[model samples]
Target: MVKNPLKIFMLINCLGMYDWSLSAKYFLNIYVFASTIQNSGSQRHMHFIKKTLNMEIFGCFALTEVSHGSNTKAIRTTAQYDPTTQEFIINSPDFEASKFWIGNMGKNATHAVVYAQLYTQGGQCHGLHSFVVQIRDPKTLLPMPGVMVGDIGRKLGQNGLDNGFTMFHNVRIPRENLLNRTGDVTPEGVYSTSFKDVRQRFGASLGTLSTGRVSIIGMSVVNLKLALSIAIRFSATRRQFGPNDDEEIPVLEYQMQQWRLIPYLAATYVLDHFSKTLFMDLVELQLGLLQNDKSIRQAELGREIHVLASAGKPLASWTAQQGAQECREACGGHGYLAMNRLGDIRNDNDPNCTYEGDNNVLLQQTSNYLLNCITDRHQDKVRIESPLESVNFLEDFKDILGQKFMISRVEDCMDSSVSLAAYKWLVCYLLRESFQKLNQERKSGSDDFEARNNCQLYKNLWATVLQGSKVLERPSWWREFSSYKPTVGSLKSKL
Candidate 1:
């Protein structure tokens, strides 16, 4: 409902700092549930979006099953078409097939966008499809017949959110409930889509999926901002032993303290810029979807955004995780107290590393993206590029890999360009080595799965870090940075 993409994400992110559940409410309503309906559903679903923004209806996204998390294609929840009634029978065949980790379903959501393996009356499984299924009564807040739903109980943090689980026992929804923009079933029991290839349809679907991962990049950045505010502001005021015996100084004045915390501050700025840019890229993708642009470039745009969001979430989450820990430890005993909110920040950030997508597994998506580009360049004899031109620099990988770090003085390293050059070389070097390692496994009779699984141990591409390096520079107010006091409530960038 919020028109500006940047402000929408920023507002959700800042609201998260106040209380994660509050932000999760908007995030689920707008980003995850409604956004999917907007993209993959037709005009009939537009009113759901409006009602959700108006608080008339609440919703949850049901995709991850109890037994399967990220392996979405293998999920067992099924929606079989019954042409006789013009309805889809949604079912959870077993306990493991139940929808798990569903936000808002615990106690509040009145409906869900349930994903199931769609089966036609002819018994052909047509892969995953989204359907709007009402799970709770709007007034009573009780589960509907054949709907099993409840909260997951107290968590380490973000307990404000009623995270829950669900199962459906032959629950039937109208044929029109299906989010049918990508794939739809006729009342006569046939599955059809505008897309000629299943792969193209799947590619179109990634745009809806990538929205969460992309937004989390900004969420993680904001976490770092909060932790940095508490730590840096504390460092600037809380005095300790100084150069002289009688004169105590702020802990921040010490070289060691600065060394430990300053890189994270620098990282915060780098990541902030990276998060915003990645967000804008996703905005461009959604804009294309709005216009219904199905060009090769549009398909490629989804893929490129997917690749960046996949990796950006991990980098931002991990960086915030580390930053939170460092900031907490830097505060010493003061940080351990709950009122200080360090522990809350640390615990809230832990889920970011796992949710949306696991930090480690998502990086492989980036690795695979880079590999596909490399493969296209070599085997297909095509240029390595994207509509975003993110990995287009790989066209000069050979030249970049040929270069060496030649900086010999401390002064030379002060400029961030030195770091960026070294990082470019490192990415190119790691990429070529990873490519060789994967090929070696393949040549050794390893199948696609084995090749990928075996090569997971290898270091991989870092496009997010590439962006981070570009933004990591000394503050223009470095001399006056000692006067840089962070605001208590607002986490605004002075630069």
Candidate 2:
């Protein structure tokens, strides 16, 4: 177990700089499963780690079903406990229930940590549970009996990764194969859990799932940096229209080029710091969990971390998506050339916005968490207790809501502080409006899901904007801006 999880993120960032597709495959297949098993406390499967570290066995995570991506609860795959045989049977009832878009599962993986609905002897379905199931033989590279697996074919990017699919038909494994940290099934087929609340237990079980999303944040920064580096360097070198016929100006000197590329450059610095800080926070939470600290504070911290990841993934990914496209366009015909690598960067990053969790669906989680905080404060159940203080400003909701944008000049708006204040106001306003819409929907006899869906537009926008502003605040780039003036002058000198 790495004491600092951020180190993993940094390593992924470096790998992404070389090849994002390779980094994505490593993240989805190795890093995520490793983190899950470490947190899962499945001692019986610990050898999988040794094999992985020794380069003996490759692994993939299988969660997304053919018909169910974000909706884990709706997955139809079943793992039924058989007390008579002292084993668990894993099965996919239909094609729709087959696992889809599983990285590294098609061609290379020898094992998988599969998520399936658990069933005891009493015919009770106990939500989703993780199971370590052997998918292929290490030496022969063949699928096990009763398992159907194959590659998903080529993709827009990440074609190097064998994104695959799997289906199981009455595949039986030992009862000990279950990842039973939060809940377990005994030989007698009794299902037991430490937490009384199902939701809380689910939360505890998924404490480490954010690792992939956190890494995506850093990978997005890498993508942004790559795109900006190529575009900016090209802009500095490529010459165009000039004031005199005898000389041509560097593209970087054009205000349009600066406007297109500089802000994203600044954002790259901002998101880089934000991603590292978030990774550190994740490390702290994981360390506490590893120490078996089940305190309420730890649980709250986990929840906070989840919300941050849910929002941060989308924020960083969408930024990379837009930045890559912008950079591609800024470099003109040269960026379109395969030699420059901008196209691959753009295509590779597109999936980040949709994977782990769909960006829009993930935003709903953050918004729902925010709504709960506001409700808790209003009902006096608790103060705005954000362990990370990401939402502590909600405590001063009234004041924040009252604030109006006052910056009248472009110069004033350029200051980070002014931008922060304005964004805070916007977040507060959107939060209030979203809350009102949700309440109105509920008052009309809509269920929680309906109410949330009704407010999706505001909730999504609020989370996205709030996360961007938060990241913008994490880096001390103003001083760096002052120091980099000479570099800008040098680019101009090329004219």
Candidate 3:
């Protein structure tokens, strides 16, 4: 195993991992079913219906591989067809190509919805895709033939998961295993999928990625809240440097400490509002997608929400990580102890920057989506509408950046309004820079791969811009704050 067992146990304890396990099972069996019955049914049900449906549990989502952590196109595992038995012959081909870093994968999971390259006619397959594979006995929890599984071992945090790696030496699963909602395969060795463009098909796999990003953003907000509350309360009580030239004063009084804590406090408020707004918007998008087959609005919303989530998570997580560090430093020595919770908070939030898409790689997705809109308007004469309007700053980019947004009536530095102005300008600045870099790449004859990699740098730049804009423009979260809305009774009275 790659992870240290002891540290894993401790981290798991800190995170209430057992509680998550119970909650997951409960939701999978009950709430998730109740919610999805009218829809497509629990994804778990869709993946595993005939194979010991009640007793078995699955731990799979084709995300990370030993060699290709974020780049799905590089994954080397293959699920090729076996004509005689009508099964897919699964093979790792090599160690670096082996499946790794999957949660609940060690010995806890009996089944996995494996991701592999689909091959039919011996021609090279184009992209990564998902398939159902039974790896162990649901009752026994042991590896099956031509299969190997074990833990990845110690990390900074997140230990409850039996994150493990597996190698398939010609392991086999049925040919009917392909999850065909987006793509499919025929028994006579044929490939079929709705997506004509390979890139679009690749993108189809990431539809749920936005949901994960949104949840992580929400998690980052709560984590910030927890750390802030602890530090703020402690600072109010803990006394340090001085008052009337004699007695010690509460640490909260120190301007330096307040400076460190207050921005985080303000940030937590901003992120809280941002998360709530994104969630509501996501709900509407989800509902529309479920109700209608082709939802242009929802697709746009998904792209927008994903961009927001990707943008907010890195900002909020990096902020929370820094805030936790500050909180620890502010508390002096006691904060180092696990009991105080700041260190644990830091450890937990650290992964947020790397997982569910590494912050850098994920940022490119945001930039790509934004750039696509910008380029479309310029090249196709396509008049962009909807959420792209949020990016209107792109049109007046030079003017927006050349002058301060709210010059004359600049509010107090601490006021939320001042922060909003800074944030808006940052967004405009980054958007302009991204467009400029994109245009330059096109002009300079850079290859598609190099251009895309170059865009990653702009993504990080935009993140900083997005963070500054959040402080200066509108708080996404504020829309959801109950305090901002009219009372339900007042609305009812109008009715």
Candidate 4:
């Protein structure tokens, strides 16, 4: 965890280039699960943590349900405390309540940190709680009695790791299995926690969720890097028609190719930088968890991380998704070949846009966070700030809005500052506009849900680079460009 961020991202880039499935497998098996137990599990869970870190035992995280994906509070699985038996009975009330898309559980994992609603004596459900459940035999990998587990067979891509689903039918575990860092149930069925506020308890319990999404941002950048590396190299070397029969030039000489591939190249570097920086901020959040900060600032840090990750994941994943497609198309027939790995890159990147959280849903999450910021700014006079200082700029929204975009010369566009100023203005403008829209929708009798969704279009402005040289020059062409295509009889006939 203390490793250099650059080295880690570089490793992710290299491993993902060879195959994204390996990169995913590495994270799902080693990183997130370890962090989850550390954050949510108690001292009694030390042996499990030690074995996991030593790679002596395998584990997976089972939180997402088949029926309820994002709406975690409404998840249907239950873990009821049996006072006389001194055990908790875990059950999936229906097929829909079964956990789905659990990584590592499909084949290798013997244990899982299963999330389910905790019930005490008299069926008093105390919301969602995590429990350490042994799902398979240590030596034989057989499903434990009362548990029905199976692999979710193939899909779009990243099939190297087996994803799975499982349902529990009165599966029983000792009362000590509950990961009760935030809240715990007594052996006598008494529930107690430091935070009496249910919202605070929920926030503290699920703080680790943001970490997984933060990690996904880096993975997405790696996919973009791999795609850009392959496509840009191909563009630079693959020759096209020349100015004359004796003269030929690479397709990279064309402006269109540069326009298509160079931006993504720049984006990879930018996202790479952001991913590293964001992960460093993640260290602060993890520190608070380990120290049990329990302060308002710690709670603010959690909210900040959630907002950033909710937005950043979509930004990086969608960028990678679009970049991969453009790269595949830019390479023409070569990109389509499976051997080249371009198609693999594209398919692998596609999952990022959906998993962890769907990009569209994430965009709405970001918007809701923004709306809250603006509302506080307007009504409570609370300063727009975050542990990461990401939203701090909004405090001067009035000034930013007042500032005008005034670059007249085309030469000014080459200066990075020019675009940056315009981008800031654009962001401020959108924030202001969306806030008003939400108010307008509410005035027109729309609920918060409807107002938030309606404002998604304007709330999506977030992160982009490049400049001069012999840059935009078309040195030679007829080989790959349109200039020579008309002359070729084979192509001319088609035209």
Candidate with the greatest lDDT versus the true structure: 2
Q: Kindly report which residue stretches of model 1 are placed more than 4 angstroms away from their true locations once superposed.
A: 459-495
Candidate 4 regions off by >4 Å? 1-13, 453-495
RMSD of each predicted structure: 6.6, 5.9, 9.4, 7.1
* TM-score of each predicted structure versus truth: 0.91, 0.91, 0.80, 0.89
* Candidate 4: tens digits of C-alpha lDDT, residues 445-479: 99988876676665543311011101112224423
Error of 4 at 286 (Å): 0.8
The sequence of per-residue lDDT tens digits that candidate 2 reaches over residues 259-354 is 778878888898899888988888888878778788988988899889889988988998898899999999999889998999999999999999
Model 1, range 79-122, lDDT digits (tens) per residue?
99999999999999999999998988899999999989899966
Clash pairs for candidate 4: 240-479, 240-480, 241-478, 241-479, 241-480, 242-477, 242-478, 242-479
Each candidate: what lDDT?
Answer: 0.82, 0.83, 0.65, 0.79
Model 1 worst lDDT run, 10 consecutive residues: 486-495
Candidate 3 has a TM-score of 0.80
lDDT of 4 at 120: 93
* Model 4's TM-score against the true structure: 0.89
